[model samples]
Target: MSAPGAGPALVLASSSPRRRELLARIDVAPARVASPDIDETPLPGELPRDYALRLAEQKARAIVRGEGELVLAGDTCVAPGRRILQQASDADMNRRFLELLSGRRHRVYSAVSLIDADGVQRSKCSENIVKFKPLHADEIAAYVASGEGLGKAGGYAIQGRAEALILWMSGSHSAIMGLPLYETRLLLKQAGYPIG
Candidate 1:
């Protein structure tokens, strides 16, 4: 058996730099980052809440977790009502996403999953509501032109310049940025991972 303070090394099942940076805020660095390749297509009629959690779990389990390694994964999505807004793949898509979100309240669901060395899977979800101030054409154009929203869920990075456009927000800002530090800490504690 390992020493009382010893624990399995952490493996992050994602390639997202935001997630890595977020982990750094809590001073918990993963021993390795394993990018999981999985189909992220949502099931027909799936709700946004379920979609985020499912993706997180799947991403976590997709990694070939080696012995003595605990895998952590997370997924974030934007949804207005039941419609899940996918990550913008291009400038046009990004502009459209921003246009849709303008002056509207939307939900950002961030879900986290952890698989411990003992193979116990634990998960949590953080749902945040955010409303953006009405965006002008030039503002949206400039934002889209900046290319920060491309490839990001909700077509905006809460931690970036997009923050200036936010009129109201409730819930964990860390979650909206990508990972929920509070929930992540809880999962780490539950897994007996040392956290300072």
Candidate 2:
């Protein structure tokens, strides 16, 4: 069936502006953007990759849509070792997270899920390694004070002031910012979302 009503032609089950911007890069505009309400907390002992994929798929299926409509969702996670660093909610947590990541490489996993009209689901995950320069106490303090990392995973926003601290990286930049464009575009196109 054709896109339902006058929506963009797809449904984006996320509220992240970054995800929306990433989608625009591939020319896939959602017919309706519904921020899926779901528990984002990781299950006990869940690995970062598993958590990210579960969240992405859960978000996609959580959104209410017609049988003929399609929904897309995504999740990004920062993991140092097997530990998943959650979104920093305060300056203290930001400081602690940054200190842990001061001069080490961490994994950033981004997972995308697509649910088609017939309820078929497809997903892909992109993993990247990001290394940050050893940060001085003052530097971490200042970054925390800036508050850019407060709402970000692993207590940092790679797209903001935190970029200056990145020493090297290998992986999708878009994935670190919360969405993996290459994987996302491929998924959307394969699902017939009219994306480039």
Candidate 3:
């Protein structure tokens, strides 16, 4: 295993453009990107926080790698109460998600996992609370038609048109967007990546 701060090579095990953009914010680019194919279905009775962590770690583990490569992966889950919401795959699902968020507060759990060159792994989770405005039927319908909610956890993209409907949010915006910058940087730094 590379010693702490030994600057091992880095690989990203995710296909998320948002994560790419966020990594650039810290001026650390991965040497390569790998798309790990894995089933993301929530386990029966699995809580959102645990699911997020498991997915992140599994993605990192799923990546095929060479020696001296550190693989990074992340997952984000939206949970209201104990119910974990699925990505809105259709307009109907989007509408239903919006209805669930209307005048309500929910938690977003974002987890980042890193598998170091020596196969040692570490992970961290960012938890945030997001509140939405009481959405009316017309706006919900219009937003659902916009299609921004599709494939997004909680059926809304805060960086897109959904911003207008947010009442308040307390958490890492990067995490909500898909990856947590603060935690990601910390993990990388400890794993020996110079975030210059």
Candidate 4:
């Protein structure tokens, strides 16, 4: 799918600027960014890791792959036990998410899927543990009012002010932010997408 040392053109199956920014940090750029439309509703009793992987693969497959083009997709979610915390759709839901996450450890699962030019799909998932400091009612209220939590998984953005609330974290910060760079780089390199 490539001539000499060159790699196949990459099609990022996501519109997330964050993901694109993360890729830029590694000096990898997608030839195109495709927005994938998929129903993100989790199936009943589906585990968090499985749910994330499924969404990533589904998103990659949803995009039409051109000749010699590779499609990459990602999914990230916060899971408290078996529950998947979705992006909060409203202010109240955001507040509730913060309340539930307060003073506790939760799992952030980031999954990535890459489809090579040969149509082989490779995927990986990263699980990170994060603990937030005990949040006061006023704190939650202030955060909710700031409106940064809305539309973010677990009702918070790790790269934003929410990082201040985190007391500790384990695993990849990039994973919590939405893409696992280490795992992603390995997949891309394995699929012959040139990277150092």
Candidate 5:
């Protein structure tokens, strides 16, 4: 493992390929990639924004030993009103999530947190509005059968096959993918990481 402050090495606390790809886009090459296992059950009356931030912080803290390494973590949630729509683990759940988001505008919240070697934690939240086209029964079934939404939030991947269903999107594309590049860059810079 790379030592802390060894040319700004980062430890990414997530297993999401999308997030990993997003980090790569910003030229961040993590020295260690650790996925934090935590209870993601939302608390009673927890708003989506609060839930996202809490999860992000928890993830970063879970993987840290207070050694002062730069730890990065993030969480993304799809919310229609106060309801949070998470990744569908099965076909039925994907179908129901798609039915609910079809032809409607929903909010995507992504929270990013960074814990520096000094144990100082900083977090930022990014929100985006996405409008999806009405989906036909066949389209939904086909998409579900393709299994692309199996592990994606809101039962779709904005950067994958589901891109066809998006009518409009307002905000950073990287936010929808689970990391906001501008915000992430800011956090990394604050943590003393050099970004070209």
Candidate 6:
């Protein structure tokens, strides 16, 4: 199926609502949303930035051959120093992550990869710093109970109910949500997609 705007069919190799929403912000909706099933385990001694880029590229390449369509994939990671934080799957994990991030600065890395119709691949990375306010146990418990951190890297969503926990943030707000709009638009343009 073709996207609302006419062009070569574009495929988003991801299932992230945040990524889809960011794409909508640029008016470059995907013709298909295909979640590339790839193992996201970090490589031995792999830095967070490299890990994100590698995963993004792997995701795009996993779905792109002979499809005759452009494929876009992205990966986001949150790191506190050299430690990469995994997506919280339960309230206990979320609470622990929040505690770790309290009154501290962490980095969010978002990597995007685009494989054009010609099979030429291009990629970019976005990094943002976020500072969390000191949180009381009750506050953390409430946020965890809200269930907004599940499936989210860093145990928080800058665009969701966890917004109140942020003391300050420096970088692309969209990147924090999982996609960097500026870089995504550039990749779309390079893939010959029309963007307004």
Instruction: Please state the error at residue 180 of candidate 1 in Å.
Output: 0.7
lDDT per residue (tens digit) for residues 1-196 in model 3: 3234447778899998888888888887787899999999999999999999999999999998789989999999899998999688999999999999899999999999999888899999999999999999999999999889999999999899998999999999999999999999899888877774
**lDDT tens per residue, model 6, 121-169:** 9999999999999999999999998899999998889998888889899
Over 4 Å off, model 6: 1-5, 64-67
Q: How much does each candidate deviate from the true structure in C-alpha RMSD?
A: 2.5, 2.6, 3.2, 2.4, 2.1, 1.8
For candidate 3, give the lDDT of residue 54: 98
Worst lDDT run of 10 residues, candidate 6, spans 1-10
| Distance from true location, Cα of 18 in model 1, Å | 0.6
Q: List the residue pairs that clash in candidate 1.
A: none
| Local error of candidate 4 at residue 41 (angstroms) | 0.4
Candidate 1's displacement at residue 40, Å, is 0.8
Each model's TM-score?
0.96, 0.93, 0.94, 0.96, 0.95, 0.95
> Residue-wise lDDT of candidate 5 within 145-189, one digit each (tens)?
999999888888888888988999999899998898899999988
Report the Cα lDDT for residue 26, model 1: 88
- Residue 123, candidate 5: how far off, in angstroms? 0.2
Model 1 backbone overlap count: 0
Of the candidates shown, which would achieve the greatest lDDT relative to the real structure? 4
For each candidate in the order shown, give its overall lDDT on alpha carbons: 0.93, 0.89, 0.91, 0.94, 0.88, 0.88
The TM-score that candidate 1 achieves is: 0.96
Off by over 4 Å in 1: 1-5
Q: Roughly what TM-score does model 2 have, to 2 decimal places?
A: 0.93
Residues 1-196 of candidate 4 have per-residue lDDT tens digits of 2233377899999988889989988888888899999999999999999999999999999999999899999999999999999999999999999999999999999999999999999999999999999999999999999998888889999999999999999999999999999999999999989888
Q: Candidate 5: where are CA atoms >4 Å away? A: 1-6
Clashing pairs in 2: 7-31, 8-31
1 or 5, greater by TM-score: 1
How accurate locally is residue 49 in candidate 3, as Cα lDDT from 0 to 100?
97
